[model samples]
Target: MKSGTVSQDYDKNETDGKVGLKRRLGFFDSLSFLVGTIIGAGIFVSPKGVLEYSQLNIGVALCIWAACGVICILCTLCYAELGSSLPFAGGEYYHVRRGLGPIPAFITIWTLTLFIRPSSNAARALTFAEYVSRPFYSGCPPPELLKKSLAIGILLTLGVINSKSIKLATWVQNIFTILKMMALTLIIVYGFIEFATNPDASKPFQDAFNSQFPNAAQTAEAFFQGLYAYGGWNFLNYMAEEIKNPSKNIPRSVITAMCAVIVFYLLVNISYLTVLTPRELISSAAVSVTWADRMIPSWAWIIPVSVAISIFGSLNGGMFMLGRLNYAGSKEGHLPSLISMLHVRHLTPAPAMIISTLIACIFVIPSDLVSLTNYFSFSSWLLVGLTCVSLIVLRFREPNLERPYKVFLPLAFVVVGVSAFLVLAPIIQSPKVQYFYALLFMFSSIIIYIPFVHFKLKIPYFNKITCYLQLLLEVSPTDMFEDSKTE
Candidate 1:
């Protein structure tokens, strides 16, 4: 059962013109992808939720933030081992398929494709639109149609960029990531200066831990909010197949990205506290924006503009990986073969990109930012936790398999434990009807899988449809190569 003994025919398929993902991404590209994807609108917006749940206790809120960072880093390490060992597309789906079985793998990608990813993309897109429109608003909230249109417009722009060239997409990601970091640096630097000059600025920290204590449920919910901000740390693994020297790069990128974010998050929270009291943070809808407005009213415009840029970068990263997910699923014969096709001229998965874009656009209509975050966090973490469990199973089942990066067994257990807590805590605290609806949506994938994949039941004209799609989509032949057994 171990990957070393499994006799990977996948390599042969790659060499036999059966796989088409190009290996053009390097370490920095992946690093930028991770940072840009993780540092999106969550940090700007979720502080309110985190502060509220922590009962306005600055010390407790900071602890929850640090705890979430630890959990995210641990999970990243687990993914590092898998990504380096497998170095494939599809990320969690591939890991689960290899360690657990195809059924779980199918379900993982099914939920991600149909719900999790699209919903997430829509949320980021909407956040981008909201921030972009903020400066233009006179006194009333922007029109709903205006927001939706802007969201769709940005989605289309990113989709086009991604469809044309991955290089172009990564370039966009890198530039925006650097810009975002600069913006954040400005906030942190200015906040520190203000704290140094203003004698009473440390008042908030004086009694940081003395505020009203939250119940266990509230603490868990606060941690969940922090986790939402830290969600995209694992995105680099989704394109592992495209990363150059993946065995080395995957672990390095994960470590670098996680460490950078953890430091930035801790500092950002400190910066927020310096300018605003715990109660102020709880009441503010946009913590970062409020900080900017207070710190420099003349330059207040920069906050919303930078937030829009931050979200644009996230949307770009999301679309870039989503297409790869569809391509991975198609390669496994779990989805229509058309999705696996690479554009002949551009060397991108055009059809998959379009499909992902269209689905995300549809999602924009039904959900708001907060609900989308909750829905995605609950369901996606359930699978993420399962994927981490797969690492443990594979360690025992495939002990001989080569892993360039190996997470310690104890740490892996902690990851699984934390993931379980995150998945269950919200439901236990206050079960919403949406949780059941999300569950129903996930389980419904089983019906489609059994009839199509498990039983291999052919629907009418399926082959012809795939053939026509192949032609229309300009799918290149699959690439095949011998699987390297050793690094």
Candidate 2:
């Protein structure tokens, strides 16, 4: 594999021919980054929402979650291959740029920096604030300002961690990831033990495939909700440039982390159901904590503390990844290079980190706790569908590019992606929350993109075909006219 190559312009500027590679992140460090990005408050809160839709058939709910996970794994593999071959810092922004075109790619990065990443960070921080205050507030809660203040604090703290040092930030991430996993394992083991000791205590599992199954429309919405719980399976794609060996390590980390999360999610969901009846889980908002309380005495706080830690890690993870995306954009001259400024002493993207944290703080202010999470989930899935389509399009246009981790069944990947896209129609038709958010943020992004290109940056071929294709796949075609033109 080619170890390093500088941009042609950079090489031209150098007096002597010399290209430098960024510092390497080991396999375990990459895995830790993935784990930290995922395993957040969504797992704790989203399950209750899924149970609300999938009531009485716990096994079926678990199965649906597992199915969503499988589809995510397929997409993760596709991204892994793209990331490995191209090995850039910006994650989807890089892939989309290489596969789609500059304009669309710019839009993706713009949306991520301005909206999606901020929304994600805000949601996680808000979740942390809610849990942190729960013990004091009990069933009754605090004033709105207090909650927002706490959320902002959470964002700032995580931003500080990210800006300090990548090594320090990732080390903290690895520790939290391990702790969160252990906490989950404890939940699983304790629940199973309770089930074994008192079989009569558990409720019967639900059968999702029964004839009395909810109508296709209702089932589709439930599946969509289930999909949110498995949303962060692509976290590894964002940190491709940081990995020690992009060609091989990036692919392995993405696939391995996704697969592991899927299994962990499945097992945890099953354990949750085994301990609590579907009816109980559906009704209880804090189902996981309640389950923990029942399994062990004086341990209700354990679940809350653990979940808070997990969410904290997730908040930092999103900021870290999004910081890189913005940093990469600045480096490429697509965005103000000032945003790309690294702390000369620390070598971290402090400006982007602070900016991301600030936006996140803003998002958390107007929104209540629950809407923030749902909004992030809604926007995340819609964009994920867009990104997946970009993947398939890039393949046909750039067939010969090296792929370190290709999706095993290309047609199956396409089918799964298409099915995911189709499912969104029903989800939006039933309740138009995510659709509204998707349109609002995306249109706003386009508005910003037009000016950023026309005025701020003299971007070359902003609407070129190669740029659009790169938006889907990470690799741009060497020859522009190789593929038949669509437009």
Candidate 3:
């Protein structure tokens, strides 16, 4: 049976009395959102997992980095076609629901809302706190209480900014993105100078490929680490409904962000090599901080400060899009109707962001949230592969659908293949208990789906509760978006 989405009714609802999100975001705004989300603490504090799992092989590690970028670009191509055609909020959820069915969509979003996004955001917020708290405790680690408090503060700050004003969020995102680029560019320039003048810089590259070989499982883990650093390539697609001229801007923003990030990442990795040897690079807790100490010991404090600002932008972008995901899901009746609401005056999805923030606050207490990113990658790639499959399914099912930006059909298949490898290689080569746990948790969602979503069971007095909460939150049920379809 074919399934339909409320996105088709967006045009009709736009003229109704309900308030909706505005098309205030342009090409640069969209671009900043993607870059801001992608260039977070992963690059600054982490990346050691990538180097370590690659068996300290500089050549293989660099190849894995480049390969991750290429894989994301392919994924972006599939998203570009969907964004240009569907032009809806919810991104992967909407695309999956449209091409596959509602059951799959609900399960996908259930996992993301319940675990994936909140956990990832919490990890980034904690990374920010680590940098911020480092100065106070010079020799030893910061107190657990202090770190957790600061992480929760970050969540609240960004959540309020997003709920307050779209203009303010966009302004902050652009400024931080430019700052991130400048910071990385400065490292790149300095690294090239060091590599040119210092004879030791060439040592790592001399036998880059001759290092010990990593097993298939190790390689797969390394790839996930690199891809983690390149996460958020599809963030712009999440707000297609909010972007101006989305058919044109989605492609422009995604492509530009990818090229800029890919070049910066490759150069930044090379720069790290110039100062720190392979062992030092892998041993350091924070990659950028160590690089700064080696290159500019007097100003070593600046890198951590800039990295905190970079993560601030990244957290804001993630929260901004997460609200839309909940809103889109609610509009489709998969989630509570309250999540679909917008602020009466601001017209922002404040209720959704607030709820997501509260969930993130819970996740902030767990100190090991960053390591769990690897375990969660199992489900993340599984769903991503499913989303790519949706692209191919939609192509055949809706051949007549207007597609202002059609990518080469083969590109979608490449993403599907890569996603499959990422998901399966670990289990096949060196299965971990986490993989088993991840699979168990993913299927367990079916329990919730069957009772509430599939059977259409209603909670008693849910309507009254929704109404009371709506009034308390000062929000109203609003239409999703204007049909941004461009011929």
Please name the candidate that would achieve the greatest TM-score relative to the true structure.
1
Candidate 1 TM-score, true structure as reference: 0.94
**Model 2: residues with Cα > 4 Å off, grouped in runs:** 1-21, 201-203, 206-211, 368-379, 409-416, 419-423, 426-428, 431-437, 455-487
**TM-score, per-candidate, Cα-based:** 0.94, 0.84, 0.93
True-vs-predicted CA distance for residue 136, candidate 1, Å: 1.9
Best by lDDT: 3
- Cα error, residue 464 of model 2, in Å, equals 32
Candidate 3: tens digits of C-alpha lDDT, residues 358-475? 8888888766655665677767777888888989998898777778789999888888888888878767777788878777777788888888887879999998999999999999
lDDT tens digits, residue span 167-196, model 1: 899999999999999988988899899889
Q: Model 1: runs farther than 4 Å from truth?
A: 1-19, 368-373, 480-487
lDDT of each candidate versus the true structure: 0.84, 0.68, 0.84
Q: How far is candidate 1 from the true structure (C-alpha RMSD, Å)?
A: 3.1
Give the alpha carbon lDDT tens digit for every residue of 199-254 in model 2: 56464543444424455665566777766666566666676656765677777777
Worst 10 residues of 2 by lDDT: 476-485
